[model samples]
Target: MQEIKATMAGSVWKILFKEGEQVGANEDVVILESMKMEIPIATEKAGTVKEIKVAEGDFVNEGDVIVVVA
Candidate 1:
C-alpha cells in the first residue's frame, strides 16, 4: 500500500480518480488550488485506488494524506 499526500496547503479542487479505480504510475489523482495556481497530485506507482481521504472543496494541509493506493 502507498499513501499519497498533499505537497502544499491547498483546497482540493477536484478528485480525478475514485476508489477502486485503476491508475498508472505518474497518473494524476487530484487537483488542488494554492496561491491561485493549480497543483496536480500524481501517483508514484500503478495500483488500484483504495481510499480517498479528502473531498472536493475541502481544505488540506501540507503532508495531509490525500489518497491511498494498493
Candidate 2:
C-alpha cells in the first residue's frame, strides 16, 4: 500500500485517475493548484488507486493524503 501525499498546501485541481484505476510508477495521478500554478502529484509505485481523499477545488494541507494505492 502507498499513500500519495500533497507536496504543498493547495486546492485539488483535477483527479486524473479513478478508484481501482491502474497507475504506473511515477505516473501523475493528481493535479493541485498552489501558488497560482498547477502541480502534478506522481505515484511512487505501480498499483490500483484504492481511494481519493479530496475533491476538485478542495483545500488540502502540505503532506495531506490525496490518494491511496494498493
Clashing pairs in 1: none
TM-score for each predicted model, relative to the true structure: 0.98, 0.97
The sequence of per-residue lDDT tens digits that candidate 2 reaches over residues 1-70 is 9999999999999999999999999999999999899999999999999999999999999999999999
Q: Assess the local accuracy of residue 31 in candidate 1 as a C-alpha lDDT between 0 and 100.
A: 98
- Cα-based lDDT for every prediction: 0.97, 0.97
- Residue 7 lDDT, candidate 2, scale 0-100: 98
lDDT of 1 at 47: 99
Specify the poorest-scoring 10-residue window by lDDT in model 2: 52-61
Which portions of model 1 show Cα errors greater than 4 Å? none
